[model samples]
Target chain A: MSADVELQKVSVSFGNFYAAKNVSVKIEKGEFFSFLGPSGCGKTTLLRAISGFAEPSDGKILIGGQDMAGIGPNKRPTSLIFQNLALFPLMSVADNIAFSLEVRGTGKVQRRNRADELLELVALSGQGNKKVHELSGGQKQRVAIARALAIEPAVLLLDEPLSALDLKLRQKMRTELREIQKRVGITFIYITHDQGEALTMSDRIAVMNEGELEQVGSGHNVYEAPHTPFVASFVGENNAFYGTVISTNGDMVRVSSQGKDFLAKAGDLKDGKKHTFQKRDKVIMFVRPESIFLKDQINQADNIFSAIFKTIEFEGNLKNIYLSIDGVQDVRCSISNAVETATLSTSESIELKFSSRDAVVLPVGPLAVD
Target chain B: MNYFFNKNGPLISTYLIISIGFWLIFLIIIPQLYMFDLSFRPNIPTLLRGGPDDVYTLVHYKHFLFGSETSGERYNYVDVRVFLDTILTAILITLINLCFCYPIAFYIAKVASAKTARLLIVSLIIPFWINELLRSFALRILFAGEGFINNVLIKMGVIDTGINFIAMDVALYTGLNYAYILLMIFPLYNAIETLDKNQLEAAEDLGSSMIRTHLRIVIPHAKAGIASGCTMVFMLTAGALATPVVLSSPNTFWFTQLIYQWFNMNDNWPRGAAYSVVLLTVSVVFVLLMMKIFKVKIGEIVR
Candidate 1:
């Protein structure tokens, strides 16, 4: 039921601009794969190329080890659920679900039965007679899923199908979509701009930026060990200190920022990680907000910084204490709400420290800014 | 009525109401009432200056429908057939226009680029800017024995002799189709332009062939436009007088031409009014039937 998707240096160009430039990635069979990027980042273009709507200007798309260049979307072993759902508004719910079957010249009774079974699978069994307009947003999403599943394609391509729904429904649907993919045991390529969605449902994610594949790894790896500056900033909140490496160790490096040296995780030498940044190479040190702690909690660490507490942002469960440190733009410490956080003064100087393993240093490139 | 007051204050609302009342009385209701009265009474010439009969009768209606017998000959039966022929011709013209205009409409609305669509629109409108009567007369010359078409065909070695296109009803069909094409194209353009392009792509992605895509999606979505275009074209074609008279031979007469003869040539206003009322009834019933058949609402059709 599932198939691997491979692209061997596929490039999609439009006259002078390349929508997707030499992107090469593979989705393992039965894996929940996601392409996460902001709008116009060529994520959708890559998806369209795989689905056969967009013809790649160069290279090949191989599905299950077969070249899919000449095949169309209808002939290919893939089905795409459009962003708008594109459910036939004039058809009844059952008919909309059974459209693929109807086009294949299936018998009426069999198509209706299949529609009913899929409807029940989606938890909309008795509502098959209703029009599409009568259903709620979540129900329509499920109907679209059912419609695409009726083809029983090897890969199901979804193009931000949940973006139109409200937040609560969208959140609930993310789990349902993952469960459905697991139950069906098919390769699902989900395209979304929301990192939260990708992190929640995808087993592996390919982060795209400006028509380039920035990083491709599992959700945990992409979030915790981003390979580039863009991924470090875009995937989650991180405080960046721009500097250059002063020295390199076995799998770590000493980065100097504003005459202060701190040891951080670079990468494994055997695997050629961190793009193998050498001594005196310009790099950016990124530490997650949650990784930084008050100096008292950490007696000794590779990095320690002292700054004046400027302001505290109360965010329900956690509080962000903004600090203004000299020679650095600003440093922020994320601490759980407590009596101490509430009692912190605006001008009081404080010290914060983080473990060297928690801080990563990579060669400076593009950073995702607001 | 309260809409006027709500949108416009007392002064403007008063003016709106008065104008609406005047429009309805003088333009719509009074004319229809007069036609209804005329249809019910006997024909009275202007020279006689006789008032309508004290009691209304269906004699004029009967005479229009079933000709009055005189000298043991059927008098007005040909006109009745002429009326039926007129309706049938109108229906044929409407269908031809639909088949003819649908592809071009699709090209303009969905397929053509912005520049090409604009060029096509200008091309379609520029020719029709000429007066309709002159256009029909021009067509009459174009379809003559040695007209543009025959000359082209002969020069291309397709025909040995000149073809008489007008005598075979070709000119009438051509003129009517040309006249009412805008009514069809514009409505279809309006409808098809609003269809989301993704819907078509989704259908294609779902493995629907081109024909099935239209049958299940595009055509059903454009039903209102089809009904509207058909209704307007049918009414216009059925009631046409100038095109048929100018294009056809002397023996051919459209139903409107017969009605014209009754009112002006024969001085039978009562009979002409009766025929007109019947024509109006047919058109209304046709519109309703079209709406029913297409499963479209009157509001959707007019929109």
Candidate 2:
């Protein structure tokens, strides 16, 4: 059974501080939706609100078109998997998976059979009789998922369940979780601070900051065309330039930063409108590191700047070349390993270029804190 | 031993070891060994203590099962009844105390805010500053014929006359429950506090009711604390002397009182030693049985 969840202007406030403020969104049934944000950004709080552990200070939550006001978590048709999994250590694996059914007065034989079925579904067959502690960390995670699914909840809410696993295991479980969600055909609301994870697993991602939704769209749409400066800076590495709008034409704007004029594509304003920036209106322009190319790589571009190379950071497949333009903004240029390496020493002058279409200019606002 | 020496230096280590040795030998081992020896021997005159008349016998231990025929009693009805009554009453007190303290412990550890929890802890512990004897006496006054509670009930027209708490053994039960309640609350709080709050929320999210949550998740997690708390409370209530004496009516009899009579009033140390050994053995066995039933280990409880 799957149910679409809708939040109508929901706000969760703790006295003067709001954990989530005026959030309204509709999650489609059988879709993998993720709330992606940094710590203290209220993503987990919003997940808890849907699971009924946290009541909205204002507004309503509807599941399957039923209002959830005054309903305790036990009565809600949603299950939550905690960050730590919270499997009963004293119980066997089968018992842990079948706890919800047991509490609902299911017969022991049926419970065991259901538990075994779930174990095999999670690719952990014949591992039900062992104690919970006897399982590995990933095994415990599957057991927690089985326990949550045993209730046949219309929605499954996971609050960073793979955060505890190591990098390799976390990556493996990400695909596993996505596969499980598809097989179950239920609405899955995932909460995470990892942008890459959100991009990889979610059909649609909601980017949140300071208790408010910054942007909600497909992963490709968000990364390529972010609506806010926070989303542009937070989702991935970007070199930001502070300047004022010199002129506006169509959907492109020319901005002057540090005695230099640059042409850039104008993005939507904070209010989700096409903002036509007036002359001398303060704005911040963002360009992704990968978009900036070495002068030799791209012969001609709309924007070109020369800077002294500061350093080059070596990754396995790519290299990040950091440079300073007039000692003002630190610019980073990421190049693939397949490209020819620039034979330039530190402090050497180099030319960098990027197209105006690849750069986005937003109204000056709060950037994501590192 | 070597770690202690390195940690504290040889001089301080020697002093600590000597102190522990002296305590174990003189205070615990010697006294228990003496009592065990005396329980197997007969009570005789001092002049014939080492003589043939002072022989080892099973008479003292047998006296517990079969009464002294000189008193014309068919069985040791008074002592045996008192012993059984003590065991049953202690168990009841433990169950009642568990019911009373579990919610309070859960509240302080999980539900209450930090400030409220601090206030509650201070309130619960402040009453324990007074000596146990004084506390028992205070309870006696609270349950007296013209006590504060009875007086308030009468003035409020809730009762025609004051209920006899002492006559009904309510006073003793209240006294014992009050005396060992802190012992139960702290262990339970410690265990329940270590539980991740997510587990409780997880159970709730999985459609488990509040009562079932406790039955499945919370109580099992806190079993170690419960086992330790119940063990301490049961032993303390069964061996209690001052509270029962001060709060129980004349008709009530405690097993400790019979042992007191044999040792002090009758001046029969052998019989008293036999009764003491029996009570200690039974209490230890009972605690072990409970631990087995609950499937808890001693290491877990201590942790």
Candidate 3:
């Protein structure tokens, strides 16, 4: 029941604007694949294209080695869970879950049985008689998943299904969704704007922006070795500094920004080629806040810079220290919530250090913010 | 009283609320009560020719079931027959409107582009801005012995002789459907518009055909609007006086015409009042029945 999905130069254009442009990816069978991006980044559009809700202007999409050309959504062996879940409000939970069977003209007894079986799978056993409205939000979410699964689709497409739930519920459902996907043993293509969710659940994550794929890899690889500045800045909190490469040796590059020079790692990303940067090339170097530490914490590091402490933001378990380095880029470093970290809130100035291997630099391109 | 006072941020005083309440009773509610009261009494006009006599009887109500008591002929079931005919015709007009307007409503709300939707709405509403009476008259001319419809059909060789369509039931239904199309379309548009497009997509993704998508999902979601629209259209068509008077053939006698004749021509005010009351009761019953059958609440319908 599982099938690998392949997209080759897929492009979905709406008049003058391309919603998904030249996007290509290979989703393995029974794998949890996620498209992570900001709003209007074409992730949802690409999902729709895969589900056949949207047509590609150019390129091909093949499921199970069959080209999906001129195929409608109903004919595609794929099911899409809408952002709102879109459960039939007037129908009972069982009826909503068994709708695919009903549409295929399955008998009442069989449909009811299938519905009951799916409910049990989703941990909602013996609740088939209740109407959809009677269920809580999380229950409704499970019912939606059951409905999609009842169709026995080869690929289950979820378009930010947990976005409407509260934070705690969303976090809980993330694990539940992953468990369900594993149990079903089908390719699960998820579209979301939440990076934490993608990082937690996805076997492989595709970071998209402006209708194009910026980077695609395992969660750790994407975060630790991003191919582009957009992926580095967009995936997580990163302190970005724009400057020119003063020297290049082997795979290491010395980049200068705001009249200060810092050594940064530039080598072959594990199992992937590194984007080579030449000397005098203007580049935007990105270093994750969590990568930087107090100067005393790591002595004699590959890169070190100091700045005046601006403010500290307390976020329950962690605190972020914002600082300005020589009236240049604003740098932020996050530390665990501790007495020592709390005392730094009153500090006027701070010193920071990070290893060259922890930093990523790409040729000057469109920054995530601007 | 307090509700009204606070309705406009405390400026609506007790006196104002009382005055409006009295105005409603006098102008609307009281008249209905009086009509029901007069329906139970004799038709004898007083010396002053205002209100009914003191005596009350079931004769007027019985007259609706049976024939006129004073008539010499064995059968005078014209009033009951006309009443039934009116109900049947109103239902027909409502069905026609539903069939005609659902596609247009769905198109404007979901499929058409923003500019096209605006243009369609304006086109549908602009014609209804003209008085209903005038619109019927315009149709009357078009359906006359040598009017536009007959002339075009004749030229197209669809028919050799011109048909007198002005006095046909088709003309009446066409007028009723057009007159109340905006009411039906707006409610349907409002309901169907609020339906998240994802639901329709979800239905389609689950192997449902376009027809089944509407039947199982879109239509159920829009039951409230359908109930409200059908209620209004049925009531309006059944109570309409001008369309029947102008469009119906001499052979056709609408219930409203019978009421008109009783009140105006025959001066049988009691009988007219009885007919009015009966019509009002039937309309109310129909509204409740529609809501019940659709399982839509009053709150849902009004919205």
Error of 3 at A62 (Å): 1.2
Residue B191 miss distance in model 2 (angstroms) = 1.4
lDDT of each: 0.88, 0.91, 0.88
Q: Largest lDDT belongs to which candidate?
A: 2
List residue ranges in candidate 1 displaced over 4 A: A267-272, A297-300, A338-340, B1-7, B47-55, B71-75
Q: Model 3: per-residue lDDT, tens digit, B34-146?
A: 89888987766476444545577888878887777778655557777789989998998898898888999999999999999999999998998898889989877877888
The complex in candidate 2 yields a DockQ of: 0.84
DockQ for each candidate? Answer: 0.79, 0.84, 0.86
What value of lDDT does candidate 3 attain over all alpha carbons? 0.88
Weakest ten-residue segment in model 1 chain B by summed lDDT: B46-55
Cα deviation at A353, candidate 2, in Å, is: 1.0
Instruction: Tell how far residue B225 is off in model 2, in angstroms.
Output: 0.9
Q: Is the docking of candidate 1 incorrect, acceptable, medium or high quality?
A: medium
- Please write out the lDDT profile of model 2 over residues B227-270, one tens digit for every residue: 88898898999999999989999899888988998899999999
**Stretches > 4 Å off in candidate 3:** A267-271, A342-349, B1-11, B48-54, B70-75
Who is ahead in TM-score, 2 or 3?
2
